[model samples]
Target: MTDDYILVLYYSRHGATAEMARHIARGVEMHGVEARLRTVPAVSADCEALSDSIPAQGAPYASLDDLKNCAGLALGSPTRFGNMAAPLKYFLDGTSNLWLTGSLVGKPAGVFTSTASLHGGQESTLLSMLLPLLHHGMLVAGLPYSESALVETHGGGTPYGASHHAGADGKRALDEHEITLCRALGQRLATIALKLGNDRGPNR
Candidate 1:
């Protein structure tokens, strides 16, 4: 059987959220769990045209099977007016089949976001992203007070989830506290997933 993996799925327009996804994946792998990084294609106004099957660079496009099969999930997106980007939402909308199958029930899930301003809806975006996962019956995970980075962060660490302040020009890199929170979120999700897996066993 294939080893269990956490799905690190995201859609990034300006690359800030993609960078955060990388850090989250790094944290996931550090916890002795596999992290499968995947991205969604940009949506086009013209439905007649199709996107390339493979992305130009970075992680490959995510398949529904990927989400359904994951041991856990860490979703990320750049803020789009207090919500997830259209492409990410579009991809998620297709997962209704998985929802019907109850494929993600009881799995641990987390959300992350990157915003252009400190008040540009990072927490709101993260919360919005969690809605679908909650509907799928996944156990939503959040960063806890025990994570020192959450207490010390001046940039983007929050108890809600990992976040980054990309600044007005979207040029600011993730701060140290932001990075720490990203890792903490990943490790926490992986640890919860492992425990759930043990509890369920092969019969599940």
Candidate 2:
């Protein structure tokens, strides 16, 4: 079997969430595991919705194979009315096959999000994304008090996962605490995946 790798998957509309994904990937790599960054395409409102086969920029489109093969997962998105955006949700809804096959069972998973405002539902959105992973029987991970950034963050880091206050203009960058937490979440997940992977042996 292939070695361990953490899949950092996300859908970024204004880029903040994508940046957070990068930070999380950095954290994963710091723990000596490969970080695979992937993103989903946007959906159109037209009755016949479609997206390009390859994304114009940023990470390439993710496939079910990526999800099934990943050693761990870090899902990210922007908040939409206290829920994950539809594009991310749409991509996840297609993972039922992985769920049915139990391909993702026992893997470690985490969630992150960015919001236009401080009170714009960052935590709730992260929680919403975790539900599907839970149903897939993945081990859910969240930031803990050991991460000092959680207490210092005025912008977005939370126990649920890393988040960013993108502001109304969507131009504000992630603060130091947000960055620290993002990395912490990535490291935490990778560490867990490594331990679990070692226990499962080469057959897994």
Mind giving the per-residue lDDT tens digits that candidate 2 earns over 27-135?
9999889999999888868632366788778899999898888899999999999999988898998988887888888889999999998999988899999999999
* lDDT minimum window of 10 residues, candidate 1: 195-204
TM-score leader: 2
Best prediction by lDDT: 2
Pairs of residues at least 3 apart in sequence or in different chains that clash in candidate 2: none
Off by over 4 Å in 1: 48-50, 201-204
- Please report how far candidate 2 places residue 72 from its true position, in Å: 0.3
Model 1 gets an lDDT of 0.89
Q: Residue 40 of model 2: what lDDT? A: 88
Q: Write the per-residue lDDT of candidate 1 for residues 1-204, one digit (tens) a residue.
A: 148899999988888888989999999988899999999988867762256889889999999989988899999999999999888999998999998888888889999999999999988999999999999988999999999889999999777799999999999998899999998889998889888875644323
- Candidate 2 Cα outliers beyond 4 Å, as residue runs: 47-50, 198-203
The lDDT of model 2 is: 0.90
